[model samples]
Target chain A: MIIDGLINGIALGCIYALVALGFVLIYKATHVINFAQGEIMMFCSYICYAGSTTFHFNFILSFFFAVIAGFLLGALLERLFIRPLIGYPILPVVIATIGIAMVLQSVAALIWTFEPQKLDPFSGSPYQLWKVSISPVHLWTIIITFILIFLFSLFFRHSLVGIKLRAIAEDLIGSMASGIPVRRMYNFTWGLAGAIGAVAGILVAPVIFIHPHMGSIGLRALPAAVLGSFGSIPGAVVGGIVLGVSETIAGLYLPKEIKDVFPWLLLFLVLLIRPEGIFYTYEQKKV
Target chain B: MKKIKVLAIVGLCVACFLSFTSNTIADTGVNKKVILVGGSLDLTGPAAFMGQGVKRGINLYFNKVNAEGGIHGRKLKYIAEDDGYVVAKTVSNYKKLTLKSRVFCLLGSTGSVGPKALKPYLEEDKIPLVGPYGYTSAMFRPFHTYLFNIYATCEDQAKIFVDYLKTELKLENPVIGLLAEDNEIGQDTIRGAEAQVKKVGWQAPVVELYKRSAIDFSSQVLRLKAKNVDALFFPVISSHSAQILKECQKANFQPLLFATATATDLRFLKMAGDSAYFGKGLRSFATQINHRDNSSGAEEFRAAIAKYDPSNKDPNSFNLFGYGIAKILCEGLQQAGADLTREKLISALEKMDGYETGIFAPMTYGPNNRQGTDSVRILRADHNKKDFVIETGWLHPE
Candidate 1:
């Protein structure tokens, strides 16, 4: 039972990791939390739907294009809306991201008409091993989330561009002096974040119904980001899974009324105990 | 210094002009007469789509009445606010709409949390809150004369579902399973389902609860598939209902599913795709047809809504509910005659019985029975269709 719960928890955690990875990418490079990351994921998922249904592409091709679209849109948004606010306070950037989320949500609602779209691309039934039964849809989500995480880690570790991004994250002025295009790095980080979020959205959409508000699930992952360490990629995955499993267990074992509140309670307790995060380093900024 | 004096003079002139305009408008205004009806619609939040449909319904009836003539010569103004289905926000907004806006009466208020918050206020104000879409036993209880129910209570609706299973479907000793939101309303529904099982003298079925904003219910459905529940009873919010149905389909657990009015919507039909119209459930009220077997009222509703809310045509229980409340309020105002005080409206509402405004099932209210519509009918949604086909006529309150 513990293994079953852990497996499920880790799989769910992978999703949070993907979101957290996006956060890490943007935060490391730009020192900004893209509040609209979830909405960008949602927008990309809608694109994936359009690609699959309207354009009649297979799931993989549709998903690929969706990610690409997310990347382009993310980069474009940064150029148009975000770049103009350079050297300004971070609060305006956060608020601007929020407005962008609103616009994207409204546009999606206007186009889709507030009805949740059903996507059942996969064939066949659940795979059962003893008491543990796993649906193909969830299995798909679990697999995709892991692969994306692996690829993201690889990109950040091995690639030259990734090193440039890391340098910029470490010190923007120093990286600029070292001939790194800091602005391009910022745009690239956002684009990469958008692409990763899009992937997360698509992975989850098959199991869940596609609705405009579905992307807002990203907000729930914020605790995961904080718990995992704002800069640690793997930490987010652990935190999200921990949160999901705890919430699931609480919903069943604990009082049902406070199930939604349980995850936050757990996060608060974790924060109090370990202000540096459970798995990641506690970086103290000297003001 | 010269600039400051000049600015001060301009500001004074502007203030005077504004005051003069206000005085003129106040004197000419025919008492700013509009009967304020407060609604806790989920306008721009998670269940915003449901709110939009409800707004469509309210706008429909109000427009119809206003177009022909005002309700007792007083224009019906619905002071609708977005609660977003949060309890604390609902309480705050109810205060703003009640104490600040001072709406005449709370008509057709929806959402599980909204009514729970405003109930005490409604009671204290002695305001006749009629046709609240939610049907918690608490709404029926402690007998607040001001509180009137439109939909049958969850327990009552669950009992009717069991009745349909026994009588229409002819299923005996049926193994039932219930999936509900982990909230007061959902728990109330579970309680109602459990009671029905016991009352029918059958073995209790499995009861499952999900988080309110759960995106997927496949795991829960998989467990139910193992149980092989013959009939499934669950009251789901708009978004989650569609998710549950899709998951059930994926799992191939096609049990006879019965959802309350909350799940009854065109969005459900679209979301369910091929499997939309395959169940019978309790509606708050269906305004598509009347006891006289005419669609004239429904037709009028469509036309009125088209004129006002022409963009939105996706009708559901909420739309009909909106029409029903508008009709009820209009009738109450008419019965109140020329005098349209809050007390007069309450008195008129209390006196309402056998009053048919050609919209919804006949609504009756008296001193003893505060739960309006003493009965709720079972309506079956036709697959891929807009409205439900009436299965049974007005099942009396159990």
Candidate 2:
């Protein structure tokens, strides 16, 4: 039972980490939280479903199509909604993102009609290893998440665009003055976040099935992002894994009523001790 | 001549007084041209599928009725307000419908919490709510005269499940378990199953509760498997039921599964895939006849949906429920006659005895009995056909 819970928790955590990566990416680059991250994921999953079922594309082709569509959607949103309010207060931008979330959800419902649709998993059935049984989908989720993390790490370390994004995160005004094409970078960052969300959505869709409200799972990942420190990329992954493992282990021991709230409770306790999250370092800024 | 003139004036005043009193006695929502029926439903939330299905079904029936010149020369005008499954929003929609729109009665409001929240106001205002789509025991308990429930309560369904296991499956000493949502609906089912177990002189079943938002059921399945539970009763919604089935398949644990009428749909089968048809398969208790049933009512429903709502390509169990409940409400309206009022509607509904709509089990109601039926039909998924097949005739809890 313990082994099963651990495997399940790790798999669940990978999904959370994947979603949290999207949140961290947008926040790190633009310094504006994209509240619609989950909605983008949900909409993209529907697109993938449509691509496979409606358009008669194979699963791999549908997956890539949805991801590309997600990229275009994110870039379009940044250009149309985010860019217009460049000098505005963060509250309005956040509210605008929330509004965008609502619009996306409603549009998805209009298209898909709110009926839960099934997506064929990449692999069929679970493989048993000793006493523990793990789903192929979960195995794929872990592998893909690790690969994404590695790719993202290399990009940030070496790529010029990644360096410019980091510069913008550190000093937005300075980067803007240093010939960083700030608006285009912001669009690209959003597009990247959308692509990551698309991958997360398609991966998780097989497990949870596809629905308009499936994006609410993104809200669950928010705690993971907070736990890892909202701005740190590696922190999101660690935070998600910690949250998932602890939640499952707690379910094994704690009262069933507290299971849903366990993750939030763990986040609360961590925040109480270290307000800057597990990976966040306090930086002395000159006012 | 003066006396004659005075007598004529007195006669005119008396006739005018009678006319004023007659107009005052007329019902609020009933008019010469139409009868306004209203509903507060979750048209744009997590349960939007249910809300939309119920709405479409009701509209399908109403459109058919209206096309046939309506009941007693008054057309049925349905005005549905989206509550989004929120209690406060349901109450607000109720107020808008009754106070503002002045609907004669509420027909097919979805969800248990919303209808439960409206109980007090329903009684206080002396308004009739006919055929609300919920399975909670509270819908009929304490016998709210204004609220009419159309299906067997979750508790009754649970009892029926236990009975089926003992009588049909012949599992005399089988270890039983329950996986339910941690809410009133879950508690109600638990109460029924436990009571039935005690009645049958069996060991108390292992019980596990989960949150509604929970997608993963690995821990619950593992715990149940650890207990060696041979049969499991899950009274959760369709999506959760499918997820649990998948989890069980992953863990290589195949227990005889029992679910509520909510899971007796094609969608559940699709979601669960091969896991659903594994082992003894999922035996679900259904309140309404399956849409694919060859019964006359089922045929009529399919034809009506095709004629009235061609846009709705896939009609499921919820839609069938909505259509069944609408039939009952319309029956009550027909029985109430042209001089319609809330009280008359209530009186008409209470008098219904073994009224068979062909879609639902024969329903009987009395002044004290608001539950339309306590009987449920068992359904099992046919893997080959990819649809539900009716396993048993309507079985009563007792």
Candidate 2: CAPRI quality band: medium
* DockQ of all models, two decimals each: 0.22, 0.62
lDDT of 2 by residue, B142-224 (tens): 77988888888889988988898899989887888899988988899889989999999999989999988887788788888
Question: Which residue pairs collide, candidate 1?
Answer: B277-B383
lDDT of 1 by residue, A35-101 (tens): 8888888888899999988999998899899999999989998999999998999999989989988
True contacts kept of 2: 0.52
Best by TM-score: 2
